[model samples]
Target: MTTGTSKAGMMMELSHDSTLRELTTDQGVLRYHEAGDGQPLLMLHGSGPGVTGWRNFRGNLARFSEHFRCLVLEFPGFGVSDPADGHPMATATDAVGRFLDGLGLHQVDVIGNSMGGFVGTRFALDNPDRVRRLVTIGGMGRNFYSPGPGEGINLLMEFTENPTRERLVQWLYSMVYDPAMVTEELIEERWAQATEPDTLAAARRMYGKAAFAATAAAAARSEEAPLWAMLHGLRAKTLITWGRDDRVSPVDMSIVPMRTIPDVELHLFPNCGHWVMIEQKAAWESTVLAFLTRKDAA
Candidate 1:
């Protein structure tokens, strides 16, 4: 076996206590971290080079797991999941659909951050019956703009052997209110994931081509009119939460979606950034729990 596989095996062994499992889907066998028991809640992570479900939802897992079956999916080419043969973004929506089918979950509360948010919205639109409720955090793809130089540079450095920790911290700090929250352990974990031999090349390819291309294509198709129209058509109760200080997908972009959806509610947390769940875990959990447990939502 390759060094990457050996390292992954070790990581899996260490994470066994977390109830992590490998689930086969159409795209590939995905490594997922699952917890809790009740109504199903599917969590999708952002599309950062080395992003995973754990990194996106780590801080809020305990609270959410208490009330819902929380399944954090590691997308193909990210975390421990092997790369898909086709274009990753093109096949992702179908992969998610197959995953839900494989699990025999008719409907689920879908929560996604960043790129996952984009996919969640698309999935809801494509398979309304499969999504009971939709929640997106700092979502992208609604608008089409090139990733700034800083973002491009960060994506490139993530694949390097010695990814600059300081740069990574800076990038994360820009995504949250308190830079101090970017702990050493968190940084190290992110570094390790980014540098993992199995995923590094795939990550670079995603950043360079599939990610932005897919986002642009999706945005062009949705535009403002179509996206709003789709939001209006959604039967599921929707909750839109955004960070007041979100520099990535600004709070302004969320306003139209909140107003367009008939049964939608919006929450903008102050002193927060793109990663609101991590930046304001308590408030985020309470808000989500209250929304999901509402009479109309149930």
Candidate 2:
């Protein structure tokens, strides 16, 4: 492991157990963390302030890695990855495809959370042959209710509009079922990342994109549709997981995919919030492993 100096004068492991590395993709530099070995399992993180794949999946990575070759990416415009020059979602989706192509990965089982879920949904829709098993947690673009933004989006807007550690902490608190999970270290780490000059600038651009989306949504006819998803087109064996108390993406939203997708299973974690993998680490990882490894799945 390579040792690096920190602002606090402590030596930190830059690569941290050989799990961290960078690869060049057609989209540019792609950073990621990986471990274990078997069928490729790609995990995508949410779009919360300062969100990183490591931060989002650190708790569950070890267990999941034990079962499969785990790869978690830092999406473009997030973390250390290069910023996007176009639509963030499309940019991310393209980067994902390019990343896999660069690695010569033929097929992978994908698990996406929140914004990552949105990316995964589009990826599966566009590149169905590239994915073998699919899992989406609290994914966006749903119709369990009206898809106009919710508490999580509102909180994110507040953070981007105001840009404060206090607001970021509050946002994190609202994302989880238990306040105990909002530890000081976690808060500090997220705050540190959110405060980076370039990252903060990227966030402002994202906020503008979100605002434009909201305006377009307001002008659209309410009769247009109750949802926006391509669930019917996805051919991968899928497991849609949600937390019962999740306000970000409601539990009932699972029904949309379940009814539309050809092959899908729904699981809800009672008393949990948007961060199901974090709060229900054991159950979440085990359930996902079983689904991906099932003889009938891939």
Candidate 3:
């Protein structure tokens, strides 16, 4: 890792070399951020225009790193990491396996946000012995009371298709219950990354109208069961967190996992939105840290 500095709000006092690392796996060149040392804690980021592992979990790294070796895996197809062929979600799920194999980490504790939560759950189901514990922040399970493709998702698709500053702003605002959380610096940073031609193209592959139709069609043809149906098979002790006011992948979407996962706990933050970790940083970090450190019955 090369030492560097930048004004990205997420970087804060974090120097590049101390955190950023890369591994060349068969899947691709995987980029990640590592800090401290202990039992591995692999953090996965959500799928969004300009979303990176750093931006998604940087706030909680300092706290998490103190007790664990924090590895924030930047999934492929995101601009911060190498882009891959095929649907971004499938690429991300595959990247997790290669990332662990390349690093020689047999098991880890995982904290996943939104789409990351979905990916983590899939991984834990597929490799039960490899995940010691799991923490998910929104975007797991199927839609319950809320409408499918919630408000924030619509805004995200709009931004992906148009690539306009205005649309990005709209989508950013919808991510949190408090609009104040979407600052000019955040917008500027996200806009610069999100509009990159390659990044925009990747986003289109995941959120564009054509991509949505393709995803639905592919799902209809596949024989594999949905994540909700597979939750009961997960062996990891799980903590599911959600913002009561989330517009994208609303709180209702957490219902299935909360009920079906055999070893699970659910915590809902009032007045919070999709970005629960950011919108309720202190409380969330506290909650997760406690759960991760708790002793499991023999």
**CA lDDT scores, all candidates in order:** 0.70, 0.78, 0.87
Where in model 1 is the C-alpha error above 4 Å?
Answer: 1-16, 140-166, 209-229
Clashes of each: 0, 0, 0
Model 2 lDDT, full chain set: 0.78
TM-score, one value per model? 0.80, 0.88, 0.94
Measured on C-alpha atoms, candidate 1 has an lDDT of 0.70
Comparing candidate 1 with candidate 2, which one achieves the higher lDDT? 2
- The residue pairs found clashing in candidate 2 are none
Cα lDDT tens digits, model 3, 54-97, are 99988777677667888999888888778898888998999999
Assess the local accuracy of residue 205 in candidate 2 as a C-alpha lDDT between 0 and 100.
64
RMSD of 1: 7.1
The sequence of per-residue lDDT tens digits that candidate 2 reaches over residues 67-179 is 67889988888758877776466678888888888889988999999888878877887888989988988864454564646677778878988888889988888788988
In Å, residue 1's CA in model 3 sits off its true spot by 12
**Poorest 10 consecutive residues of model 1 by lDDT?**
1-10
Instruction: Order the numbered candidates by lDDT, best leading.
Output: 3, 2, 1
Per-residue error (Å), model 3, residue 68: 0.4
